[model samples]
Target: MPAPFRIYNTLSRTIEDFAPVKDGHVGIYVCGMTVYDHIHVGHARAMVVFDAFVRYLRHREWDVTFVRNFTDVDDKIIKRANEVGKDPVALAGEFIGHFHDDVGALGLANPDHEPKVSETIDGIQAMIGNLVNSGHAYEQDGTVWYSVESFPEYGKLSGQKVEELRSPDEVPGKRAPADFALWKAVKPGEPAWDSPWGPGRPGWHIECSAMSLGDIGETLDIHGGGLDLVFPHHENEIAQSEAANGKKYVNYWMHNGLLTMTSGQKMGKSLGNVINVRDALSQFPAESLRLYYLQSHYRSPLPWGPEALPEALAMLGRLYEARENAEAMGGSEPVEQVISGLGEDAKKVFELGQGFTSRMYGALDSDFSTAQALGYLFELARAVNRLANHKKAKKRGGPVVAPALAAFASVAETLGLMAMSSADFMAEVKEKRLAAMGVSHDAVEQLLTDRRQARADKDWGRADEIRNQLDEMNIVVMDRADGSDWKVRLVAAN
Candidate 1:
């Protein structure tokens, strides 16, 4: 049986139990990129949030059909193609490939269906035809425009009254200031398609309406997008879809908050302060980026700073180290018996481990509180670390820590954290961070060789000196009981 969960609906502005359009199934459509450039960290947050939500719903046995679209035909793509002296379709295809690379590196699952405006032209035109036939829209000089005044519920979703709205100046053929274009007449040097009205392209908002209705039916269980799109984008979608279908557009609306810079401005491509996902992945492991996104409530405006990824890397390292310590523990006895012998630390680990799943589910089910879920994981880590400090832990505490060990495994399977082996994770951190810092591998290897000789010759002073030099270079040398190992330290440069 699927678990019951509640989500914060933007339309209702309240948390309510999710009742699907069809029992045991959810149809979700999220607004995807415009495909004009590489995706950035802010964009990745929306991607990861929706991806994780879908993963959780599927994990809980809910049948979910996730649809995310690509705006391959848009003003941005056209302008960018013109600037680069390339066909707009070809330029969009280039950025679409880059989008896949960036999101794939961030470990996002592919949507169940990824529709595009270029491919969904027929559907878009068909929807516009319906609106025009139903008298909800009209054509002027080959352009189709939706009469926003015809929909009495225009402000229902956005809570903005038409009279109160400051609509843009009337365009040449639009009937009213608020009547948005359903289809734009063909423009020079742009992608075009045949339609009953004329040869034209889909408008920005109408594409989503057409694609969602065509892919998942007239009403979606949940329609999601960034908060910034609530006004003109989502509001327009509601008008077009409802007017055409003569039914509800979406049962629930979900909007994620934008990532804000430290200066309080939003990180957007238009803002020119965006950090590209490709650049971020080149500097840090994908998990570090994932951690940075999941550390906050999905609906809260997350602050991006010089220390964002570094802080997240530190948090991820803590969880991995705790898991490693738990895995290293050893014992052969009943858990209760071992706990009784090992005292309070063992008992704490045992109790917290037993309750870990419940706490995780509580956080996840209640508005997908990733921050709270991680708090519980950190609590488990602390318990494990405390138990590992016991002198007998390595040889005689495995049975006691078994549940704690299982907790980490569950986290890996469920949340996609601490999924890599310690050695592999550290190696990836070194390679990515050092490469990002422009450090040469051969130079570091020679320094390590010199340090090894000093240690072999019992020149402890010389060995320490070389280690300090490497430290200054942002390298950390770990003198293990077996030998010396080195890694590039991940921290905020600023």
Candidate 2:
């Protein structure tokens, strides 16, 4: 049987039961990047949030058709192309390639349909034509404007009054302050297509409505974007889509919160404060970035600081340590017997492990609460760690931790965390951290050789001094029973 779930709908401003347009299925549309430049951590947050939501839904057996559209034709792309002396279309294509690489590195699953605005020009024109014929739009000069008054529910999604908005520079052809363009007439040296109105390009907001309806029909189960889009961009989409189709545009509106800098301002390309995903991934594991984004509620403004990645790496290491400890246990006794012998801590582990799946589903099913879901995961990790401290755990505790192992695996399959093996994750950490710290393997090995000789000669004073020097360089040297292991420390520099 398919499980029932509830999602917080931005359209209704309430948490409601999610009854899809079709049984056992979901249709989700997310506004994708404009592709004028490389994707930043701010953009990656929305991408990862929706990607994990889709993965969780499918893990619970719901059939999902995810559609995200790219605004290949946009004012920003045109402006950027002009400044760089490149063709607008060619520039968009190049950034789209870069987008795929970054998202692939972050381990996001590709959407079922990645519609591009340039390719869906026919659908956009058809929708514009319908709007004009229905008296919801009119052509002035060469531009088509969507009449705000034509759609009675214009403010339903955004809750902003048309009369309250302040217009930027107004063109003479627009009928009202709130009305936005449906089609922009072709300009010299710009991309355009032949249309009934004129040779023109689709407007930014109209392109999404057209491509969404063209791919997923008149109504979508969910339409998602950053909170910044909820006002002009998404509000305009609701107007154009409903005015043309005479039906509800989207059943649910989902908006991910924006990323704010330490200064409390939202990151944007125009602000010159954006950090590209390529730059961040170059210094940290992809999962570290994923964890940083998933640590908060999708709709809450997440703060970015210099220590964010280092803190996330620390948290990720804790989870990995718990998994490694669980995997090291060995036992065949029945769970009940082991718990009975081991007492409170063992019983806690067993109980938490048994109920983990339900707790995880409960958190995810309620408004996609990744924060709460992660809290439960941390609780499970504590239980695992407590059980591992048992004297008999190494040789006789595997059966006791069996359910906990399954819980970790379920997290990997559902949330895309802890999917990498311990060895692989450690290796990635070493490679990335070494590069960021500018420390080489050969240099570290020579330092370790001297330290080993100092210890062998019982020169405790010299050995301690060498360890402090490596510590200052953000390297940790571990003296295991058989050998010494040194690694790049994940903590931030003081």
Candidate 3:
């Protein structure tokens, strides 16, 4: 049986039971990008959060059908295309391809279905026609407008009183301030499709209504997007979808919180504060981005700062070090015997490791509290490290840490964290951090060579000087039995 989980519903404004329409199955639809430009770090958060959610669900044995759509033929696309002197469709396609590349670099899974607006035009028109025939929409000149008054429950999703809204733009034939456009009459230069109402294209909200229904059904198990979309975008979706289908549009509305700058303002391209995903990934491993996003609760506002990624990288290094420490232990003795011989530290690690899977599941199952789940992981990692400090731990401690290793594997399978081998992770850290800090590996290598020669010749003062210089550059030189290996340290968070 698939494990049960709880999720906070934006529509109900409370945590609710996530009952699927079908047994052991969930159909989820998330609003995707407009495909007009590169995806920023803010956009990457939504992508990573939802990707982790689906991966977790599947890890619990639930069959999930996830659909995220691309708004390829939007006004923004047309406007950007005109600015760049390229065809709108070609421009959208270019961005869509770039989106895939960025998503891949960020280590995200491909959504089960990525429906596009231009490709689904026929279905969009059909949904519009259904609204018109059902008296839920009306034709105004060549454009179709959804009648907000026709649906008494229009404001239930967003909780905004219709009368409080601004007066509708006088587009020559629009009836009311609250009634949104269903199908826009195409402007001369914009992309056009033949419809019963005339030559026009889908309105912003209606495209999701049609594409979601086409991919899933009349009602989705969960619908998700950024918290910013809860206003006009999601509100309009609920009205048009439920009004036209005569059924509940969605069982749960899940909106991830937006990223906020340290100044308490939301991150946006208009503000010139956006960090594109490519730029971020070029400086750090993909897991650094994932850790940075997952460290906070999904519904909480994530604060982006100069030390955000660096702090996350530091935290990640801690986990990797502990895992490596545990993996390095050598023993074949039974765990009970090893624990009996090693005392409290061993006992703590064994207990935490044994309970880790259940505790982790408990945290994640309760409203997908990734922050809480990661709390358990970090605690286990600390326990492992503390146990490794025992003198006998190197050779005789493997049995005691076996369960902890299993716990790490479980985390990788379920949460997609710590999936890489320790050596690979450590190597990636050196490569990205060196480049990010503009430190040349060759220069660091030469310094290490000079330090080794000074040590070989018993020149303590010269060796100490070289090590001190490396420390100034945020590098830590570790002396292992094999040799000296150095690592670039992440910045400490304030």
Candidate 4:
């Protein structure tokens, strides 16, 4: 049987035990990118959070059907395409390609079902027809609008009163201020689809409702998106889906928090502070970005900073180093014997490693507190490093740290961190950091080569000068018995 976990539901505003519609199965649908532009770091948060979440659930043996949709025919895409003098669908397709590239580089697992509004027009229209037949929606002037008053639970998801809300728009066809369009009428120059309400694209909120139901069922096990979406978008979804289907829209509403700047402002294109995922990945490892997000509670607003990736890289390096140290040890004695012989450091590592799985489960099961779960891994890493300092640990500590190794493997399996081998991790770090610093890897190697020759010739002063020169570029030169290796060092803030 799969392990049970709890998740925070935006609808109830409480963390609740997750029970799937079908036993041991989860059906989730998350609103994906609009595909008008490349996904920025802020967008990547939702991508990474849900990706890791699905990874975690599957790791615990839950059969998950994850669906993330693309709004390929949105107003934003049409406007952007017109501005760029391109066909709307073509522009969206271009950015969808870019989205895949950015998300692929970020090392995210693709959602099981990546539905698109353009591809699901029939399903979308059927849903709108259902709403119209049910009297929850009305057709006027070739446009269809959902009447908010028809559904008394209009603000149940967002907890906003309809009377207190401002007019959604000053559009002429809308019956009430809160009435939102289910099918938008054709405009002068925009993409149009043939529907009962005439030629127009699906409204923003209706796409998710239709897609979620078509991909999963009338009710989704969990519907997820950014916290920023909880209001009009998700709230309207609940209204339209339930009102039309006569069933609950979703059993659990899972929302990840937004990424905010140090000034407490959310990153947005309008703010001109959106950092594209490709640009961030160009300078840092994909895992660094993943760590930066997982370092905090999923529901906490992550503060994006200049040093966020660097600091996360340093933390990741520490975990890798500790795991590598534990892997370097050699022994086959029983774990208890090794622990008893190696003293408290060994005993601490053994107990912590033994207890780590349940503690990690406890944290992750309770609203997916990734930060708390990572804390346990960090504690285990620290214990491993401390124990490696003991004289006997290197030779006989393998038996004792075996469980610690398994703990690290569990992290890789569960969280998708530390997934790379230590050698690959360090090499990629050097490659990316060196590229970011505008330093040549081969040039650094040549310098190391020169430093080694100088040392061979007993030219201590010359070798020291080369080492100092490398240090100036934030590169650390490690001289070992086998050979000398160079690693790019992060700035002091890291």
The digit string of per-residue lDDT tens for model 1 on 1-494 reads 88988899989999888899899999999999999999999999999989888888887899999999999999989999999999998899999999999998888899999999999998998899899999889999889999999988897778988788887686999888888898999988887888898788888999999899888999999999999999989999999998888889999899999999999999987789999999998888888888888878999999998889888888888888888888898879888788788999999998999899889888998988888998999999999999999998888778877877787887766666777889989888888888988888888999999999999999999999999899888998998889988877767455
Per-residue lDDT of 1-494 in model 3, one digit per residue for the tens?
Answer: 99999999988889987799999999999999999999999999999999999999999999999999999988899999999999898999999999999999888889899999999999989888999999999998889999999999988988899998877476667778888898999897898889998998889999999999999999999999999999899999988999889899999999999999999999998899999999998888888899999989999999998888888888888999999999999888888788888999988998999999999999999999999999999999999999999999988889878888999998887667898999898888899889988899999999999998998898999999999999988788887778889999887424
Cα-based RMSD of the predictions, in order?
1.5, 1.3, 1.3, 1.3
lDDT of 2: 0.91
Off by over 4 Å in 4: none
Clashing pairs in 3: 168-177
The reply for model 2, stretches above 4 Å from the true place, is: none
Candidate 2 per-residue C-alpha lDDT over 1-22 given as tens digits, one digit per residue, 9 for 90 to 100: 5688889899888999998998
**Model 3 weakest lDDT span, ten residues long:** 166-175
Give the alpha carbon lDDT tens digit for every residue of 217-308 in model 4: 99999999999899899999999999988999899999999899998999988899999999999999999999999999988899998988
Give the worst 10-residue stretch by lDDT in candidate 1: 410-419
lDDT of each: 0.89, 0.91, 0.91, 0.91
Runs in model 1 deviating more than 4 A are 492-494
lDDT, candidate 2, at 183: 93
